[model samples]
Target: MTVEYAPGRLADLYGEPSRPTVLLWHGTQTDSRAAVRVLAESIAELGVGVIAADWDSHAADHGRADLLASVRFAQRTTAGAELVLVGWSLGGVTAAGLTLHAHAFGVTIAHTVCLGGAFMAEDPITGGPVLADIPASAFRAPFTLLVGTADDVIPVGAAEDFAAGLRRHDWPVEIVEVVADHGSIAGARYDAATDRYEPDDSAGTAVTARAVATHIVAVARHA
Candidate 1:
């Protein structure tokens, strides 16, 4: 469903709010709803609610303002609910940031999941580095990193490095590898016409989706 808690900003929410809520954030240059629709639905089927928020990271404010607004909306709407934050690629970076500073938003995140996340990178909004060796004490929840072994966009080593950094800080982290690429993890392909992603239904896509979904469910169960 479409959520318009803030004017002009839309978020797609899947599953019922009574279940565990997962706020999903998409990568840069992609719509959250379209990019994460398949995965969100898959997670919802497992009895978990997912919210995919649409925010343009390339916007004038670097999408940070919009992301914070979305976070507030999620917290307000899902009050007293167990909230898990999930993000893909750039969105993953943002999710990690939010989890580290969740106290500022007056929210407590149960856990965090990052898919093909780019961590310890420079922040476009602040013109400085982001997630560069964050202290473990800053994080109150565990983190799970899922990346494709064949991912070309963000190499598997990036996830390993991030995990190592977290481990050094004595943070709980788990890394899962899937047999697919970046786009295939979500069963999506670029649609040139509309500059968005379209779902793929090949046999291989189905298998990969199932594997990823299973791993996600396991993570959620443990969280």
Candidate 2:
């Protein structure tokens, strides 16, 4: 399947790109780089390449296929380069899936950061149980799963269970909970300048972005 993607921006933040790269997957109903522009900018400042993937708005299979395509595209775009996968909301779950599917694209995924991943056995789109089993290598790389205390969509119970399950599988799973709603946890830290969503506070985005960036750097250093 040809990965259908909407064009995205890739501005060089520093002089030359000498740092690692990250593949960012946005949540549903939002652009690939949504709520993550600030984080991307910060990472870019460190000389890391950022590919904020934008998918066809109409094609949404709980974002699985889109994310797969993103991994493939990243493989081709960043060949012979180090990669870290970052996903918010549905994109988070996609990040997990990529750990196992990266070989299909001939890429070696170094790490993953899942922000408010709806990763319960229950599918977010169908509310059906996830049929696929967690891969043994899923947790081989370090992963940070960040959720919100006030998130109503992905219940806290489910998040805990999912994290526990990954840990049991020997995956390095770090779960962090913040004070915010689902959208906020995903970094849609509503901006009054744009006025597209609510909770026009940058609290969640600021905190979560820092946490993610810190983890990314730590993992890269150790890897």
List the candidate 1 regions with Cα displacement exceeding 4 Å: 123-127, 133-136, 191-196
lDDT of 1 by residue, 114-178 (tens): 88887765443343455554544574688888898888888888888878877777778889888
lDDT of 2 at 220: 54
- Which number leads on lDDT? 1
Off by over 4 Å in 2: 1-19, 30-32, 56-65, 121-131, 135-139, 190-208
Please report the TM-score between candidate 2 and the true structure.
0.71
The digit string of per-residue lDDT tens for model 2 on 1-223 reads 1133424522222223333568776665544454556566555555566777764334546545555566566666666566777777666766666664555445677887777786763443232443255444433766777777778777877567766776677767777776756665544554457654332236646665555556555665555
Specify the highest-TM-score model's number. 1
Each prediction's TM-score versus the true structure: 0.88, 0.71
